[model samples]
Target: MKKILLPALLLIVLALAACGNKQEEPAKEDTPSKEQGTSDTITYQSEEGPVEVPANPQRVVVLSSFAGTVHEFGVNLVGAESWSKDNPSFDSFLKDVEEVSDENIEKIIELEPDLIIGLNTIKNIDKLKEIAPTVTYTYGKVDYLTQQIEIGKLLNKEKEATEWVDAFKARAQQAGEDIKAKIGKDSTVSVIEEFDKQIYVFGDNWGRGTEILYQEMKLAMPEKVKEMTKKDGYYALSAEVLPEFAGDYIILSKSDTGDNSFLETETYKNIPAVKNDQVYQVNTAEFSFNDAYTLDNQLDFFIKSFLGTK
Candidate 1:
């Protein structure tokens, strides 16, 4: 009777151990099953169509001039185009990032980026695709506010981008009110730049702060200036005829040797803005930047230059 009782007890112990082992098996399977369901990538619909990009891209490469926007979004940038490299705000980032160009496909491959970004107008899309999943944006496909939001979506940071947009708009709107009070509500603001032999007036997009001076600040534009440049992004002018486009206030941007000594010339000096000392000369390379970082700096400049408050 004692031997029979011992054997039955042994069988019960084995049965309990088997149940414990079965319980552990499901936990081990849970992790891999989750991984299989949610892979490393998320599908982002690009202009080229839907493409799977790393959900959290670690190494990013930008093949266009919009690197500043990427950096502002707090992404890891391994490579970028050097259009804004000289800007002091970008000096630190440029130090660590490789300067990429269309001709430098080999260098891009060496960087081993998880993703590559470029303008839709960028060449070598097929070659770039061989390296990694690539996304492209059209140059004027959207305004600055919408473009940033779109970029955030592409990078899987939509919430962050939306937060920034809301905050920036609030600040910009307030700045606009201040500007109107200080500079007069009816005052017209003009954005003009000199590049090489050309003198051009700009519209609300691009890098001339038109969005800030005109759109956000509620500033008016000279009718002739508006008629000429409202459709085209810019209008070219001869030095002699610049007075026609001059406004109550003018923001002048000059590139290296691009000014053509126009500021010193009687034609430019005779403009009402020049005589009233309302023409603000901003660094062309600096002002040409239209990214999130540059916009913040420019807003401060407008307030100080026009409102005399820091």
Candidate 2:
């Protein structure tokens, strides 16, 4: 009876030791079960409504003016609109990017873009949405800087976009101060573009560096331009009235293809800015948009053009 009791006690001790060892062992991590799902998309609150977009967009197509802004965010652009493609400043980066338009549904389909951006005016919106998450913006719905921030939110790069915007504003302000010191505090500036056989002057928000010239830099706009373009943001006039809109300094944006004969006429040639060689000519395609890339370029151009410093 004693031997049987000892054997029973020993067996109990061994069992208790085994339990302690098991308890001390590290737990195996839980593996995902078949019922679990990993979502690779996020909901973006676009102007139209809430839409699901890839959390990390691999291929993107831009069908409007935001190409440069998107490109500045380090996004991979597979296709872009003709205007963006035609921009000489974008040539190096967009060399491999295909030129696409709102009308090119079949072509865009072939690109298999995970994202599509365009203006609200684009046709085939529904079809584009079927192909991928499509986001559109109504022009002038927001200020130029806010527009960039909006795109940053859409792309999940708001932090980066905000950083850029802040830094840019500071730099532009400094540049403006430097320019004012050199050109005088009250010297006025104007932005004019020649297109479709007509001459147009722009307000502060209009592209072609108007934002930098008037808004960011706080430079004075010619009273005539301010009066006419105050409501429309831009005004079209015959070449005869060009002098009325002329300022101490002029930024002339002209397309090589447009009828630029007006620039040769005495009416335009006699403008104070032109006669004083204060006119800085830029390509319409290059200076047309207020995107990050274009804005940086525009700012640099202004610094160099005004101060003769790179």
Candidate 3:
């Protein structure tokens, strides 16, 4: 009887050990990462510094005046940092957002945000992280379209972002076709700006020009402009070089106070674009700044400009 009891007890112990092992094993394949608390995890890289994000952030605080991405993602914004040049349209989108400070770490901490997003150039990232997960984006990382996609990825709305871009592209293409029909194919245009008494011609690669010149009209690149862009990619070039690399049309951009004073100058008068009265002025807000809503409006105006309806 003792031998039989001993063997039975051994079998029961082995069974118990097996059950314990099974319980200890983690169900890797069966469980989803979302349920594993990965949604709050924040991950971002930028020229500014390393940012660690909390998992599945609920309330987010944004510390930048440019909240174009918020509208794109339709995320609830808890706060935004005020910039000197905040766009008025941003007010409608950010009606719910509170104004955070550039230096006020305590204010950000009080919000209890799950994450924080801002430009890497901002100096408050480390301080902000003590309060919540922080992510930074470099300005040079993407063109405006790609930037929207990146923002979507961070917000976990990548599909929506992709669709938005596709819609914009289709609209821009249709607008482009309508525009080219008016200006005629093979017409070349220059993006000109006179700021602070200095003339600047943005290359085809310029953010605004890239959309209008590359995407909209499919205009040809100027040889000299291409040469300058070969190095730093794109920049504001001198307006004085207009005659040396004259274009068929000069789309001039002006400040609030700019007038025909350039027309009074001999150099501006001598330029082929000016001589033909081909100079066209665009608003600074629409073209100079590239945001989701602003770009949409600018694209329409560019279509009009090309159609000769402006």
Candidate 4:
């Protein structure tokens, strides 16, 4: 009985020792199921539920003023809408990209975009999805820098995108400091654009408004500018009320070529900006809310107009 018990104990000890000498978990299978991120749909937070995108969206279409944001991720955009000239706060190099147009929906469909980007309130999201997977963004409603960061997450380039923004912030800070020293601390500024319907003075909450108030030439925003928000946060005002919205200096944005000789109207001549030559007309189609290529132009424009010699 003792002999049998000793042999059994020896066998059990050998089995326990064998179990302790286990191997690794077969290198985790090297499969998508083992990955932390989703294998099917890449998820992103939005106004609605999680916005899902394909894993490797090769052909992409962008219809927002976030061309810089997408460009930060090193994505070779298959399609992009023309740069929005209405908001001069963004980079303008995007205008040179030959982006697609909403009017040419048939052309966009032919591109076979894997992902379509648009503002959260884009006109035809449902229709866009019928042609491709669309991701809606609340762009104009948020801060300019915030929009860039959020889009970074969507593109799975959060780290790289943040680096780009950090560089941009540095650029903004340096530009602001330089312009402040050149323009003098007492200087004030305003921005106005003539849209299809009416003239608009960008508000602090919007892109161009924020750029003037916070970036570029640092200046105090008048109370009238804040009131111009009008609930939805932006409103168009008639140029007749230029005095009401006018500041010590006004940066006027115009569509198409930079020539403003055509706008020598009687009313335009009387405005303090035009009268004193305090109004500087910038080419919107080339710069506003554009992309990296033209961002230097905006920065330079601020320097030349409000700051000093280039």
Candidate 5:
């Protein structure tokens, strides 16, 4: 009788343990899978609409102005447009990046990019989309910093972009305050670029550090530049009237190949800013874009040029 009772108790304990194990098995199955946590694609709310892109893009190709922004985000850039590749500041970073364009479908296809970025004005949109997840931005649709934030969203690096924008704005505004103190509260600045034998003056939103100087730094824009560039964001005029656009300080963005014979002219040399030695000359290649990398470089240049500090 004792042997039979002990065997029955043992069987009951073994059965209870089996039931407990079965209950825990379903809980494990109900939990999320590793594959579900790491999806290959994520939907991005682009300017055009929602488009699916790689969650962690390993290969990216930029066909327009966002190369610096993308590169600054630390994404792998397999290809970029000629302008970005030719930028002297980007030389070391883009040394291995292939030079591509909107028209080069075969070359782009060979790169096997998982993501492609460009302006809305690019050609062969449908063809590019067929090859990879393609996203395009309309120029000036958003402010430069906002554009960087948007790129960060696209790259899943919004936090980093937002941090950069906040820090940069503060730095630029402080620089502006320091410069204004040194120069004067009423001192005005003008951004002038020489391209294609034509001279142009820019407003706040235009590239060429105009955004940094007028928008971020809160520097005064010459009234003539404000009036002329108010309509087009930039105004083209002859070098003879360059003095009319001159200000207390001038940011001269010059292209290496552009005809800059005007710089040697008496009219240019005689301008108040030039004569006062307030003209800050920057290469168009280095100063053209408002991307983070370029903007930082521009800020450094301004600090060194204005306050004479590194």
Candidate 6:
């Protein structure tokens, strides 16, 4: 009896030992190793500091700007600010995306985004940080082209961003030369916008094709206008002062609310640009973005408007 009991006990102990070995092996083939788990995330240098972000983020949210850029990069978006929701190009892609209210923190938190991109001026930034990793950009701190590149770097797509910038620069240079050939090289251009209460003249980087006109297109600005706006980025003037800022060619940006009656007035009509039929009116909704999307659209507009060839 003792011999039989000893053999049975030995068999049980051997079976238990085999099970313990299997558990200790940690199922390496089926389970992710520590190194593999660590690889799922990466640290990015942001305006605030180094931040850990997903190595391959599947959900991203853009709050105030750069929605166009993110879309251009083929990244998946989980939400967007109300402004992008109205963009015709973004409307379809954002149909399912939640519209984040810039004024409301709860709206953003509900989206469960892995990342959030916005302008530095956005309100409630502290609350936004609580929801996800947030990165913010200050407009005018860099040129539009550089800003886009910075955003691309933040998203880990610097290569694509740089490639696009190179291509766009080449295209813009060609367009500038073509425009200068069509219109006299000496001809000057101005970018102006009429808001509800004020008129503004912009320099090279404040959107409304100013970058393309003054920087990329190499279009000249009137000496007086340059002296006033070159440092401030923009000059605000009354309707009566339109002629002072007007150039040989004017790109006028208007929003839905601004009154266009000023254009009919003799003051505006008498400007050389208006008299020469060189005032190209563009919608603020379409022309205000300082992103690649707006740049591409405005380039075509510049060609058609200036060269009369699409």
Error of 6 at 294 (Å): 1.5
> Model 4, 52-131: lDDT tens per residue?
67665666787655555576577657776544323344334344444576557787888888878766534667778788
Candidate 6 Cα misplacement greater than 4 A, ranges: 1-38
lDDT of 3 by residue, 1-310 (tens): 1110110000011000000011122243421121122455544432343344444346777654235565656777777755312334466766667778658887777777887776555576678777766666554344446656656666666677779888887887777777667767666776665545555444543444445465455675566655654454333445455665556777766656654476577887888777877777665433554446556766767766666453
lDDT of each: 0.68, 0.75, 0.54, 0.54, 0.74, 0.67
**Candidate 3 vs candidate 6: which has greater TM-score?**
6
Assess the local accuracy of residue 78 in candidate 5 as a C-alpha lDDT between 0 and 100: 97
Compute each candidate's TM-score over C-alphas. Answer: 0.84, 0.86, 0.69, 0.70, 0.87, 0.83
Candidate 2 residue runs with Cα over 4 Å from true position: 1-39
**Model 5: what TM-score?**
0.87
RMSD of each: 22.0, 23.9, 19.9, 21.3, 22.1, 21.5
Q: Among these predicted structures, which one has the highest TM-score? A: 5
Error of 1 at 15 (Å): 76
lDDT of 6 by residue, 204-254 (tens): 656567777777778888887777765545667898988888889898876
TM-score attained by model 2: 0.86
Ranking by lDDT: 2, 5, 1, 6, 3, 4
* Position 127, candidate 2: lDDT: 95
lDDT per residue (tens digit) for residues 1-310 in model 1: 1110110000011000000010022232221110111367877766556777887878899866566667778888998765545455678777778888656899999999999987665578899999998987655545566666767776777788778878877888898888888778889888887765677776555465666676667788888788886654566789899999999999987666454688789998899999999988887666665566667778889888988876
Report clashes for each candidate as comma-separated counts: 0, 0, 6, 7, 0, 0
**Model 1 Cα shift for residue 124 (angstroms):** 0.3
- Model 5 collision count: 0
Indicate the worst ten consecutive residues by lDDT in candidate 3: 9-18
The full ranking of all candidates by TM-score, starting with the best, is: 5, 2, 1, 6, 4, 3
